[model samples]
Target: MKEVKKMAQKCFPLNDVDYLAEDLRLFHAGRTVGVMQVTGNDFHTVAGAGMQTIVGKGVAYLLTQIDGLGGVVYANTDNVVFNHDVADALFNRYDAIIIRYDKETNACALKLIKGTPSSEPTKYIPKRSETEYELVIKYVYIVAGVGTITNSDIKDAILNEELCGIAVDTLAKIPTKQYDDQMKSWISNSQADFKKWFDDIKNQLTEDAAGNLQNQINSLNNKVNDLKDIFVVMEEDSYIPPEERKIGRLYFNTTDRVESGFNNEIRVSPNMGLKKV
Candidate 1:
């Protein structure tokens, strides 16, 4: 008689032995939580700071992107609009603009977290916790005598996937040997296959809207070129460690969204992303 080894919950051709809920939760738990550009609408859309209102595109902040979701109840995303006053000379200080998710209230909204006044003169960012997952979008520095906030006054605070050890496409490129057929199809398809997939999804949608979104990809104008335009940043300057840089991995840099010269065999890019049935 020979001894046999048992497999994990996510084995392919999942059946009675596999707990689908547990598998999904485990999958979602393995990734970092942050705002992700899911619908090809906006990646980091945000603008404004004044007595008037600021504008930002709707955001998706959940494991549903880089990680699998345990379950989805209902999530309706929309653009963000905020109003803040830049302190005029008298009360110059640092502040943080954040998107906060409160588990207790089941609410996700934008908030301005105030920082200590005149403390070493640095940008302000809010604290994050298990219950209150705050994604800091921008750090603001209110200058004395200036009531206006400019690009120079704002700094990006979006969670960096590199720093978090969770690339945006990490889940997309997981070992397909263990994933179900759909996951394998998503991960293993080439651009030509991807174009067909894109066309299929588009066909299911209303022609006018589908045409627009499909055109958005076909034209390669609106959406970020996640698959095609290889990020050209030098690997030496990347924050990723040398050992972590592996072939067949897609790398993203805020400045340069390029692959780190790793994958020469096969280029795997995330899907163009499909919405409701």
Candidate 2:
């Protein structure tokens, strides 16, 4: 007994095991390509003429759970133009948008393969082959008489896997604001949420033993007011009022008038009287 192994950096299958193709594509494109092309919703279909199903931009190695071997191939380079016209008055049927990979040539391309006509939509069989690996990206249900196919008629097959996903950021998904008639911008939806950041900073400063900025400014003003007690000033001639003469107090006394201006004497009170320096 031997264990089956797939090659590293590539997928491989051993001969004598009629499961060659299936084994090779088991992890083809690594189960999910993760929505490679962002443009036009990644291979989405648009409602159009009954005979024509428009597939939007598609570029990825696509697959589905049921497409064991044929579920691994590169899809169309761009939007697909393919006809899935009514063969007759169809009761109902499913059509697959597949990426066909020809192993012999190692070339991959897109194709719209008609599924087995089914009265029950769930019973429709999509394309699957060994040589030409047909990876079904989507299952499109053809409405009666081939009416316009909308998004509802198409079954997105990517989400079949746990990591299978599609993400095309649309303006509708975003919260935006129009700046003016000719301009637009994104803005905060609520003022409280926007102002919470500044409020948090102010609150943190109070808890950290560092007073808030407003408190600091008020403290500074108090300290400036206390400076009045440090020194008292007298601006006059040498005659100073007896009560005004105090130690460390300074006086600017006029000496004489000069060409520039009146000269002043600098005197400091040493005792109860002012002494000229």
Candidate 3:
């Protein structure tokens, strides 16, 4: 199921025109978050920044000019007196400024100040926010008729799109069937090589097994004979039946006491001699 995003929240209000210049000073040269049209009859609108537009005519045209100028516009309403502090605020906060157009005077002027300009990328995060280009359209409509969304709203929209695209692109990079096929081919070749090595080892072991057993048995027999002195030797004269001399059986005694019954015992003989059944 698709999840619904929370409703948009604004970090700053865009409706208040009084702080527009101050906000621009801080955020500077970005798209307008919201649009405010000075509608009071007392407002004697005059151009304050980069370019000018007639105060009462239409906001769309003014926004277009601001877009072209690539800055925020601060036009005074007829009701308010122009404050130098406002001008200073705009200069500090925004890159370019437009004064309200006076149709009667036919004058729209731009204010210029000296400072190092900000990098374009920093000025507007192209992927994260609306470009100066897009804001013009959004602002003009907001100024003229349709109310515009806040700057925070616009930023949220951009962020949402960016996140979605990143997810999709990352998903696309996952390994596919083609990669699995290549891996399988490698594994098959490795298994074949391993099987050949195992077979060669088995053959070698089979060929050596008989010789290995014979060598081991001979070594054990030698070890038993080395300890023959410890056994009792019976002379022919001591034989119970006065047997003639030929060979004497050497007997060994064991003092081992078994607490458990023996399951089995192994008997060995010299090479070529038969083993006890």
Top TM-score: which candidate number? Answer: 1
lDDT of 2 at 241: 67
lDDT of 3 by residue, 42-76 (tens): 12234333222222322211222322322334344
| Local accuracy of candidate 2 as per-residue lDDT tens digits, 32-78 | 43355546567777656656777787656544333343245454566
| Comparing 2 and 3 on lDDT, the stronger one | 2
> Model 3: residues >4 Å from true position, as ranges?
1-171, 221-277
Give candidate 3's whole-model lDDT: 0.33
The lDDT leader among the candidates is 2
Order of models, best lDDT first: 2, 1, 3
lDDT of each: 0.51, 0.56, 0.33
Superposed on all Cα atoms, the candidates' RMSDs to the truth, in angstroms, are 35.6, 13.8, 24.9
Candidate 2 overall Cα lDDT vs. reference? 0.56
User: After superposing candidate 2, which stretches have Cα over 4 Å from the reference?
Assistant: 1-40, 62-75, 123-130, 162-277
